[model samples]
Target: MGQVPDLPIRNFEVAGQGPAPPVILVRSMHNLLNDAAQRALRYLDELDARSVAPSAEAVAGLSRFQEPLPETSMEPRDVLALLDQIGSPATVATAGSRFFGFVTGGVLPATLAANWLAAAWDQNASMVVLSPVGAALEDVVLAWLRQLFHLPAGSGGALVTGGTMANFTGIAAARHALLNGVGWDVEAQGLFGAPPITVIVGEEVHVSMLKALGLAGLGRERVVRVPADSQGRMRADKLPKLAGPTLICTQAGNVNSGAFDPVGEICARAHEAGAWVHVDGAFGLWAAAARERKHLVEGVELADSWATDCHKWLNVPHDSGIALVRDEQHLVGAIRSTAAYLVHGEQREPHHHTPEASRRARGIEVWAALRSLGRSGLEDMIERTCRHASRFAQGLRAAGYEILNNVVLNQVLVSFGDDETTRRVIAAIQQDGTCWCGGTVWHGRAVMRISVSSWATRDEDVDRSLAAMIRCARSLGVVKNNS
Candidate 1:
């Protein structure tokens, strides 16, 4: 080998290199995080006192965020101040007790704390080698969920982003398993020449499930729609003969009516016909944890796969969903990845069970939620929320408003006189800002949907919200009395 000559050092003066620019010692990140924690606590402390809907001024102030990005970095404290001042007020206060627009659950304190700690850890829950704690927590949470939901022993599951992705994950597994059974390798060969799978869903199937089916290479429009009764339960008798690679997607919770399909019959028939069954139990599957409501989800254990949102009914922080499959190999086969650089551990690798390769350690919050709220506490929260929903239904019915659904769970649909009048009442209630509820058209009637999913929602909160709703309706002349 030839010897290389030493490189000469440049003698030219570098620009602005005088005195090495005194090493600036910035404050520790702990101070900034503490500042954020204080601000967050203050905001949460005032959540109940604030309006469920943002005021006109706060809505108008959203323009403050529209400015061009700054060229230079700003102090973290200043950035936090700006966000708390301008951004916080414009929020809809969905974490508060009175906001009932969607089936949104307020963050449990333990879950919130766990979320902060997990963010600080900054673990990428991709592989066990990447984050052993994340993977272990995920495995523990999955086992706890299976136990709580009475799922089959040794079932496989993944933590997903939310209900939509959860549904997508389970459906992806279903597609893989069904196709693979028919001598097709979906993951390897793609859906190009694969056998067409028959998808059956109720007429009132949620839009999220349909979107998930579409994302899984299954045509949404190709589904066979089973008729739903007045309460939105799928008529089991209406199910057509199942054959070939078939999938039956059943709903555990109807968004409008909070009704459950005849899942027992559906699963039995589908299983007998060698069909894969998946349940979209976004908010309703938690009913299995409640002793009084467990009957509503009877036979859910027989389903091949299930999807539900921990953020909705479990009262965890936003963006937590669970996808469960009876056969663990199916989920692994559908979503497992391979690379020479990747580490495969003896234990569970989180990414192999989910659709994402890299994701936050959401399982930490889920574990915190389950650990903090134990079995009885969780059951109480579910039962309490259902009671609140029933109270709302009773109050609205007493006030002469039409209760659209049987108060089966924590969802109530109410209508004023006519579509126009109901819409006006809904608008008036939102504008009044005492509490916030959303409008939805159910069965050709414009109705207000109240979803009582938050643990923070107390009986007094329900009464106050009911009073405000009735007052608004009376103000709009949609209701006969202020009662």
Candidate 2:
């Protein structure tokens, strides 16, 4: 390696003005970051006292961002001040305990701090040479994930943005493995003349998996749909006869019902028919880490590949997904890039297993989360969230509402009454601002979907949110006073 020389700094002064020296940007960045940290801490501290949903006034203030771009650079501190003034109030408090919408998890303090540090480091985690720390952290994180999920010892994994990309990455590996089995080089020749691969999915399969299929050159609507039971579990026996180049996608957790398919039976049948099995575990995959709920994901390790989102259950920041393949070569073959300038090391190169050459260092936060929450801590969070979910279901049912799904996991679906009433209650709850929950149509009936995925959620938070929900329903005249 050659030694690099330092560049000379040029100083500029206005005509007839005093001498002006070169300015150091580092001090300004430090002050800006310090201000940002203080503002963020203040916001987090106020989450418990503030409304989970943004206020009307705060929402109306969003027009402040519509201003035209400035021709000149503004002071960083002033920019940060403006963002906090306008943007902070308008944001939904999804990181709060009462936020039960969209299966989003609050950030673990350790992971949040790690994200900040990683941002400061700004490492492109494509290869070991690019960022030794990032690559090493990724290796450790992948191992921890494998052991936590009870996946195969040698399984290769990649950290992605979220569940969708995770699904895409895993399915891409499946595509490569199935195509290679029949002497077709999918990477080299593409899917042009490649043998048509059959994709099997449950009737209630999530849209993300279908999007992954479409991205992989497999038509989304072309999959063989196996019917699901009333509880949303895929009927394993209803699966069609499997044939050549087949890929079976199974769900570990249903979006609405929080039910698991008979993955043991499905995996057995798929493997017997020489098919590959991929699991879209998403939030539900964390159940395997909890001793009480591990049975929900029984036999998931048998799947050829699995995709999961750390942001959902691991309580990490947004955009952390894992793609795991039982065989390393399959994932590498599907996503690896080759370039003469690229350096290959003895250690793992993350870009070889993932879909992108340049990506954020998501594994750093994953490693921080795992380190902060050991096996027992992780299990406790999962179990506690499920317990809160069950409480919601019990409270809603006791209030003369219909509890639609079995509270097997951290999802509760409640139907207030008819579709119209249910929609009204949902709208009212959103407007009430005591807490936030989303609406979903489950089994052809309008229902409120509450996902208790945050570690911040407590029993008191659940009780408070439940009280608000009942009040909203009662005000709508849906729940009788007697009931």
Candidate 3:
């Protein structure tokens, strides 16, 4: 009786005129919305309840659906209902503190909520004219990131999809700068007639660099793999003498181990040789802001360009990467494109700087994340994560497991007994669900990689994960009781 007569909810349609059209629209929306929200909420609650390890079975199960979606059988609502029906009972908690596989970061409440807001707004971040909020936010956040990392004052930044795309943008800019020096326009003129551009990369560099090169018209074989030290850092002394267009790609964070390259030395050499220096700091660049780990990334600011993922170390959501370029013109020149329908604004337009023309308001979540953490919060997170990694490695070593990596930052590589024992232990740990770690081949031997990147991770989480790993190792037949 208290409801208004002109209420908009009363006019909503729930069905089609003929055959109910399978009740696809309303049923799909209702089922999916309800199920998805339920699953998300439950995952969060379960993480809160279980401090150590969360099962990734639900996620892994979804991975099985790689084929095309089935049509006509089930509506979106029905699927949502099914998801709720199935996922409601799932107790997997990897999104919590104990999941260490990959560079997984636990979603901060602020970041998560802001991400939801970003989805709701759905503002395109490409052009300033289209979404002033997004463009302005990116401009503000870029400056903040520069200050946060203590980079050069005048450096420019772009928000990309992730580490891979960030690497692509940074390298592309490097390519453009190198070619431009010799009176060549890469974006305007294709790589067809251009002179050979030598791309030098560390042997331990991530695969994204190779993929980026391929995407930028340079084949993977064209890249020269520079040797790395035992710790997987670029060998600065062995840098080849270059005469022509050259781009030297360096790694700030080695994927297997958390070792850092001598970036200052590499930058100096690359600069002297007139080569564009690009740092692929996928998960390690943020270490510059951590007081304890800052020394490891001492020469990061000196680089011509750097790529890092906010999603990895910063503990933000997926697909958030930041690329910093010292030369603003090169960054802008490489990615900026003009369209007849798009009007140019005199102000700082986000689209003019990045590769994408129409993009989501990615800066909103990033801004929210930065604002929530501030400098001290971020430094605390970095310090805590590193400490946890050390704790994990120490516990395993105490249990007679072989510690592979130097454990410099937040990544720890360990082996159980032998390669087979180690493989079995890794499998048991993954199946045990106390924590999740991936296996990697280090110097011909398989090793477990424990990456600590989540904000939700605490000391207790580390202890629990370590216990699980040790138990799994002991369960392996090769692990001797005396040893």
Candidate number achieving the greatest lDDT relative to the actual structure: 2
lDDT for each residue of candidate 1 in 1-483, tens digit (9 for 90 to 100): 232232222233457764322222123355567778889999999988888899999989989989888997776668889999999999998888888887899888899999999998999999999899999999899999999999987899999999999999999999999999999999999999999999999999999999998999897898999999998898999999999999999989998889998888889999999999999999999999999999999988899999999999898998999999999999999999899999996998889999999999899999999999999999999999999999999999999889989888999999988999999999998998878999898888899999999989988999999999998888876756554
What is the C-alpha lDDT profile of model 3 across 133-183, one tens digit per residue? 998899889999999777887787899988988898898888889899999
lDDT score of residue 153 within candidate 1: 76
Misplaced by over 4 Å in model 1 are 1-26, 481-483
- TM-score of every prediction relative to native: 0.94, 0.95, 0.88
Residue 277 CA displacement from its true place in model 2, Å = 0.4
lDDT for each candidate structure: 0.90, 0.91, 0.81
Model 3 pairs in collision: 27-77, 28-76, 28-77, 54-93, 54-94, 55-92, 55-93
**Model 3: residues with Cα > 4 Å off, grouped in runs:** 1-39, 48-80, 86-94, 480-483
Give the per-residue lDDT of model 2 (tens digit) for 71-139: 877666788899999999998998888999988999999999999999999999998999999999999
- TM-score winner, 1 or 2: 2
Candidate 3 lands at a TM-score of 0.88
Number of the candidate with higher TM-score, 1 or 3: 1
